[model samples]
Target: MISFPFSKTPSVYLKGERLFLREPQWSDYRQWANLREKSRAFLTPWEPVWRDDELEKSSFRLRLRHYSEEARSGNAWSLFLFRRSDNVLLGGITLGNIRRGVAQSGQIGYWCGAPHAGQGYMFDALKLVIPFAFSELRLHRLEAACIPSNLRSVRLLEKAGFLLEGTLRSYLKINGLWQDHLLYSLIEGEEQRRGLSVKTTAV
Candidate 1:
């Protein structure tokens, strides 16, 4: 198992060669909102219906508060992806619904700005975060579910070493409709066996 330095902050920051993952900050509101606004049409089909105020600054502050609470309580980790060279926001990724004790597991989810999709940024971010999930978080397994029609997501998970488990019938409400999802999972040792490695620093 890989070892990571302890962080005094509520959330850990992950740095990779091409990009980095850090918890959202108040200063990120403008970039985040702009990306989401431009990608709304691209993302809405696979995501839940957006609230009326979804892109408003007030809504963003609420989201930050919720993220902070989740991180402090160890319930989840929410991070935004940024290109290392320019520090541009690429999108967001999350490790949520964490369970401890008998079930040391969590679910993974991610999104990319429309402009950044299919450019391999999400994959790089996954290499960093997946190892952190297994090593630093001590998670036994990680799960992800996506609409069957989202071929890009399917490929991403498969490439990242998540094995397809099965189909979930009407698993989640996406874009205002309850839709079936393809379930995938990766256990702790599986990722290492795939030879996935990326040097990461947590701060």
Candidate 2:
């Protein structure tokens, strides 16, 4: 009963054992907005300030459009994470700010709904996407930054084979304040060195 992209579209889709990552669709507005709104308190500390209309239907439509364009242009790939068992929307992850040429790298960011926070769903999604980035996208490195206090994110990146690179002061704005972030990176082949393998379904 799991539904996926019927054919190769401009946007890419990746599937894993327990979850799938795919391009965001406008019809997902209600579920996306509801989960985000309910998880606001749990997520706010680690996220940027939300606009007044951040979760409105109109805003979601615009966001969908942007994800489409980013995927098409090779600038970024924004994907929604869904549970495979029931297709429940679990969270979102973006491999964005892609750079080509000499620097084959991109930045990654992700979030999970509060109700699903402690589960390993996000971890599964990462395993699915990393191979797509390294093998299919043919990128050499992936980077991520997280607030120092966001211990969960730090562990997740490390568990996925990313090494601690350093820190950046006032690196990003979050929850209306400029914050310091610990930077991490994963290079090709690092996964195997760390005893991790990227599992993914072809797009």
Candidate 3:
């Protein structure tokens, strides 16, 4: 069954034609660890510090606890982006720091394995995420930050219907380094979000 990261409501399951976005389960640990291990060099550049156990089986429970809090409050969506054709793990994407009420906004962040980096997977995942945020969570805006050096990510955001909002200087620290990032955002009624759906696939 699909599980949500938020507590007040359930929006745990989302799907696209060739992809499925769902809550992560303990069974997913091995795959996640393998992906991270194989893509260590590729991903470590953008990741935070990790202890040896952070990605271990023991850490799954701690992650579950954190996700439960996010689910209850509608503050986040930590979905595993996977390919339906072969059940291969593509990457992870999320809508974090969600603020409801009058703003109804949240931020988007994502990463894909090196082998799957340029295959349009992230864009496809964004399509489903946008619908999940706007339709299921009733969020009005989605924001994303990317390092200025990450031209690939910038293009993906553009293809996914996000507009460049501006730039933030040293707004975030990644891989232990503070850096400037390009900011992008998409509102609920934007052109890219017009036909957004959880059933949309990355094919």
For each candidate, how many residue pairs have backbone atoms clashing (under 3 Å)?
0, 0, 11
What is the C-alpha lDDT profile of model 1 across 89-142, one tens digit per residue? Answer: 999999999999999999999999999999999999999999889888899999
Candidate 2 per-residue lDDT over residues 1-203, each given as its tens digit: 11324542466668888888887888788899999999999999999899999998888888987877777678998899999899899999999999999999999999999999979988888887788888888899999999999999999988888999899999989999999999999999887677677666654
Global lDDT of model 1: 0.92
Reference-based lDDT, residue 63, model 1: 98
Position 1, candidate 3: lDDT: 27
Query: lDDT by residue for model 3 over 18-50, one digit each (tens)?
Result: 788876777888888888878888887776766
Candidates ranked by TM-score, best first? 1, 2, 3
Which candidate, 1 or 2, would have the higher TM-score against the true structure? 1
> Which ranges in model 2 have alpha carbons more than 4 Å from their true place?
1-9
Error of 2 at 51 (Å): 0.4
* lDDT of the structure predicted as candidate 3: 0.80
Q: Give the range of the ten consecutive residues with the poorest summed lDDT in model 2.
A: 1-10
